[model samples]
Target: MKKLTIGVVGAGIYGNYHIHTYCCDKNVERVVFCDLNEERRIATADKYQITGYKTVKEMIAQEQLDAISIATPDPYHFEPAKDAMEAGIKYLFIEKPLATSVKECEELIALAEKHGVKISVDFHKRWDPAYNAIRDEIKKDEDTFIRGYMALDDIIDVPRKWFTWTDKSSPAWFLGVHCYDLIRYITGSEVEKVYAVGNKEVLKKEGYQTYDNIQAILTMKDGSNWTVENNWILPVTFPKSNDGQLVVVTEKKYFKNESYRGVKSFTDKKESIPNYIFMNFTQDSASGFGLEPMQEFVADILSERPFRTSIYDGLQATRIAQAVHDSCESGKVVYL
Candidate 1:
């Protein structure tokens, strides 16, 4: 295998995965790790045995990197990707919310096209075997209903960061986009309309912009419907038999999965009982974090194949997510 220089921008929680993945890659040489926080960057670089840089510009100026992974926060996708493309990097694997706006997305796409660099977004759901199974299950179905949910009560992390909070932006943009992208992936449709209703009722602080709970109805191009009930405010202390729950219900067969969770499949017989039964949706069966997906990306690039999750997918996901935000405020179904 020919060695190719690879680099990663940002060393936050998710960015760490890129570092780990690239370090283990046989074709990747000279992995540059970038972060604004010198300490975090150094710590991660030391841990992974790679060169650490405080700025992406410096890395591009010095390193002969072929491909780079942009793992910064949702808003920072453009800067690093734009820089990498300008510097003639061969590939970019950017984290979600590819760009904050559609125009920016178009600009980035145009830049990638101009530079002949492949851009891949970290829509990790595309790699989940369960999602693949679901896609396979519904491939031939003309009429389909794909319903699912991603719920997590308000989460308070160690330092209390930007992502898990109550802002005008609910977990919908942060978390719901994942489900939305998966829906598009499975159903092979774009959201034709979006209508949402959400409230921060339970996470009721005096003044908060984000809603902890949101329910959205997605109208697909095929005239099918996908509903998402996103709850990021479910109070963690309330212990239950289950930790988290996600069920994908379709007309013929449905697959339900959870964290510390159960996975079950069932054929709808029109019984009054719950459609999916609880079986072993065990830990081992679930796969999302980076290593495998990054390996797959590398494999695809080397083989001259396109990645499953490309920039266009991220753009579509962002379009639907923004529509969800619009729906929350408009109180009407907004056409996508």
Candidate 2:
């Protein structure tokens, strides 16, 4: 079998993982990195011992990339993804919430269909064994109440120091999208209506021009109701950067997962929850829930198999997120 050549856009936290996986995967022939930040691009490339480019256009022009992963910030996904699909890349893996707007999501889906390219959204929650087990149990019941709260937060340092684009995003876009996709994946239901409210005091007082938290009540098409809570205001002293739980209650059974506390540790100064489930590098070759979906995308392209998470799944998740943002702004329930 011929090895596939891969290129990655964005060299941030998540994008680095994609680079690592592609570099370590035996099926890949060559891997390249691209980022607008020259420092990050060169550093990541040097660390991984791969060629680096300043932009996707430059990378594509120079390399015979068969597959590309877009790990850019949420709002910047559309352009890179569009370029890759139009460039005839066989496989495109995008980090979730697909795109920043519903229209962009539609355009991506249309573009993928037009280009005959396979698109997979990196909603890694679907790959979680615990979440998959819950999904199986929920599938047994026709109806169930799903209440999920995923508060994957960072210290004030994230918005205040890490990146300055917090105003262009919100907790809804950053964190809520994951919960939305996970609930949809678990219950296999589309979000029909959304009522949401947001608080801006925390991040605002800290000088960030975005909401600190958002609470949304979602009504599923199957007549099931879900309450989702999202907040990025967790203190720096929190045990983990991400902390939350998910509960799916059916007539016969109840499943609850404390994902953050899956593994715990204590130190002299602070406590921490090491997330081995998402991306476990300590293993042979970065095998975990987060890496599985992406690897599956590559394998599917190589084997000509159907994708587990389609582009439509990404679009639906974005649609729900857009509605949640709309409801938060209008102070009324938004119907899908």
Candidate 3:
């Protein structure tokens, strides 16, 4: 058996997960990361006790890495990914949406092929046991699909405080891509067209130039329709930072699921819902469907297995999201 050395790009919130996840994997011999922020890089390096670099080029040149993971912001994913691939690392596990634009996604795909690198996009929703159960049930039946409704929302603080790039990312790029990818994974279909509408008042009032909420109707190639709603302006009083609902209606059966899986807690300061299934990190371990994709990425690489999702899956999701935004701007249906 061979152990692997891994390098991670971006050392922010989600980037920390990538760093911690690879460190926890038994087959990964070493884990290193790069971040442009000197403060974050120094802190993360001291905390993880791993070498940190200022640039991907520095990390690639110094470390004999077997793979690299990209955890950059939604719009900035392309540069780090291209840098890693062009540096000759043969495996990658990228955080969602691949890239904000279809052009970037296509370019990344071409580069991956030319370099013989195997790429996996971290669309972790596919790892949810509930969603998997729903997919299994639908597969066992011979019924025609009718419609689906999905809405994913984050607390207002997400865009207002969590990131400085809120203006560069809308709800469609952040939350909507997860919904779009989940719909495709569940139904084994592709989106054919989209018509969308959105409002920007909430974020605009706060000086962020982006949509507060967006709703899009998707016509799938399988002839089923889906309505996806995404927003990050939920009131702070909401128990969880995020919440969602999934409902599907087929010819003979109806199914539903919610992000809150029957768990709640109340405290003097506030009420809360802990999504233990999504992600839970203890002193020595990390577990959850949310973190499973990273673990699987290392295992699959060592075992030479296929990834659950590919660059093409990332490309299609971006295509749908781009169309959704286009429709919102043009006030008309956009065919894909």
Candidate 4:
């Protein structure tokens, strides 16, 4: 097998996963990681036992990297990615909420186009096995309402810098973007507009800079409505009612990672899973929600295949995210 050289541009909590999986990957020749935080960079480098760099420029100039993962803070995505494209990396996979603002996000879309680099956003939900089953289920049956949710209470305890901001970004970007992207992908359409309301009062009193919880009514192209609720205030250990309840909908039919009928071998459980709906699926497969998808994406690039989350996909998600922000900002229904 011809191994590829991969580098990481961020060493934050998220970047750790990319580095770990890429380093152990037999197909990866060498791993290089970059981050400004010296301790994080050094610690991750030491643990992974791979090269580390102070800046993206340093890494690009030093390593013959075939691909790079842009896992930096939301505000810093553009510069590192711009550098990687200029250096002619064959592929760039960015963790999403693509950029802090729409303008920067558009520039990224344009840059990747001009440079002809294969790019994908890490909308991890797309790769979920459960989601695949759910999609198949939706096609096989009918549902009046599909309710899916992600919560604030289920994540880590971080500083206000980590969330609660209407200025740089928020938990919506951190959390809601995934739900938005998933809803859009499963629905096979783009989000038409977002009408959302949020409560930052509790966060404000806590001296937090952003909303504590937000719920939005999203209109999709199919004329179907989807609801999204996200928060940073929910306890990380919150008990989930189903599939950890990250995904839930009406009893008629809905797809969730927790419940789906296999398409290959007919199963008795299709009728067994609660709130069960007839869904077509086969072989429970690893959704590649992690390093696995990254590897498959590399294969797709090698085979010249289409990537699921193209630059346009990221930009579209960005547009929806921005609209959600608009709805929150202006206290009015935001038009697409």
Candidate 5:
């Protein structure tokens, strides 16, 4: 077997995870980090004991990469992804909400096809066992309405201090895209239309030009509906970084998953709900759900099998998210 070399763009939170996961794989020969931030690039490289570059172009020029993962911020995915595919990287894995715009997603799909490269999106929610059960149950019934609320908030430090590009994204792109993809995965339906409303009061007051909250009503092609609510304005003291649930109602059965209530911990300083379903480091490597989806891409590349989550899946999710943004901007329903 030929050892595969992998490179990661953006040495941030998820970028570091990709590095960690790839390092644990026996088939991977080398892993490199690329980021515009010199501090983060050097720090992550030093932490992981890997080479680092200041830009994707520099990394690709120097390393013969077999695969690449794009973990850049939401709005900054298109360029790195395009470069990776055009560089003839065999496999490309990207964080969710494939791209900020529908046009970008379409172009990426076309480019991947043109290059004969395999592409997968990191919508890791699909690997959750509880969600998989829900998807199975929903697949059994054709008429099911899903009410999903995924409210993930970062401490004020996230937008106010962490990244300077918060204005380029919103809760819809940052958080809602996950919900949209999960709903589509569970229901096995495409979003036919979307109606959304958003407000920007809190973040704007803090000098960030982005939506603090958004509520979107999505009508699926199956005629069932999903209501998704997203808000990222939680205070710095919020117990958990994310808290949400999914409820599927049908004529014959009802299913609900209170993801946050599965585990709990509290202390004098703050409360916390450890995310055991996805990326639980307490267990062995194979037990973690977070890395399974990315591993699927690796397996597909090595075995020449089909990817579990195709580039089309990423494009469809991006389409619905882009529609939500359009509806929010136009203050009217957007038809897909």
Candidate 6:
């Protein structure tokens, strides 16, 4: 039995999740992190009882980390991941989209291959029970996937307040990547082409230079068509931080899922729907499909098992997203 020393980059909201997850992991002996925000670095280190550095290079030089988990902003994953691999760290767990550009994603993949690094991308929707059920049902028989509709959206505050990089990201990069990856995971196919249209008015009026919503039509290699719609401009009054639904149609089957899974709460100030299945952090443990990808990253490294989602998966998702953006800008179909 062995233990690992893990390093996490970007100590923001999702970064803390990575930190806490590794901290509670039995196979991990220590967890250290780096964040540019002095306040966040101090707060996250204090909360997790772990050392925090101000830069990925500093953390890498100081800690004998067996792996590095990257939780940087949506558009900034490349550098930290590159730093880890270039420094010879053998394992990585990266939050979704991998990188905002296909070239960056491809570079990261090449670096991982060159350095013998194993990388896992956190497209957590693949772990969703509902999505898995859909996958399973489709696998039971040769049902041709005809079409799919997936919409993932966040409340207005998510872009306006959650992070400071909203201008550098869009609904596609932030949310649609999950849907893109999930579509591939479920269908075991690749996106052949994409045609997308998006509106920037809402965020533009607010001074954010990004799309408020993007709707993409994807033609898969398996001949299935998927419509992925993503937005973060839901009225702040929406019960949850986000809302989503998935509907898949096959020749003989239909599958549907809602983010709100029969749970609700009422307070004098607000109404809420608790997505218990996404993330739950207890006193000593964290559980949920959302966290499973992180947990599995640790387990697979210790056991030498393959990651559920590989760097290639990350690359493919980025390719689709990049194409989606290209299509949006050009107002024409983009072939992948």
Tens-place lDDT digits, model 2, residues 1-336: 988899999999889999888877888888897999988988997888889999899899999989999999879999999888877787899998799899999998889889888888888888888888877766766645545444445555566666657898888888888888888887777888999999999888877889888899998887777888888777777776667788776656777787664578887987788988777774238787889877887788888888888889888888988898899999999999
lDDT of each: 0.70, 0.83, 0.93, 0.71, 0.81, 0.93
lDDT of 6 by residue, 1-336 (tens): 999999999999899888888888888899999999999999998998889999999999998989999999998999999999999999999999899998999899889889999999999998999899889999999789999999999999999999899988899999999999999999999999999999989888988989999999999999999999999999998899999999999999998888988889998989999988888897579888889999998899989999999999999999999999999999999999
Indicate the worst ten consecutive residues by lDDT in candidate 1.
Answer: 271-280
Q: Give stretches of model 5 more than 4 Å off.
A: 141-156, 282-287
Residue 79 local lDDT, model 1: 88
> Residue by residue across 67-110, what tens digits does model 5's lDDT show?
89999999999999998887778688999879988899889988
Off by over 4 Å in 6: none
Model 1 RMSD vs true structure? 7.1
Superposed Cα deviation of residue 149, candidate 5 (Å): 5.6
- Give the clash count for each candidate: 12, 0, 0, 13, 0, 0
lDDT of 2: 0.83
Model 3: per-residue Cα lDDT over 210-276, one tens digit each: 9999999999999999999999999998999999999999988899999998789998998999999
Alpha-carbon runs more than 4 Å astray in model 2: 141-155, 282-284
Superposed model 3: Cα runs more than 4 Å off: none
Q: What's the distance in Å from true for residue 26, model 4?
A: 1.9
Task: Report model 5's TM-score to 2 decimal places.
Answer: 0.93
- Where does the lowest 10-residue lDDT sum fall in candidate 4? 278-287
Q: List the residue pairs that clash in candidate 5.
A: none
TM-score of each: 0.82, 0.95, 0.99, 0.82, 0.93, 0.99
Q: What is the lDDT, from 0 to 100, of the residue 191 in candidate 6?
A: 96
lDDT over C-alpha atoms for residue 208 of model 3: 90
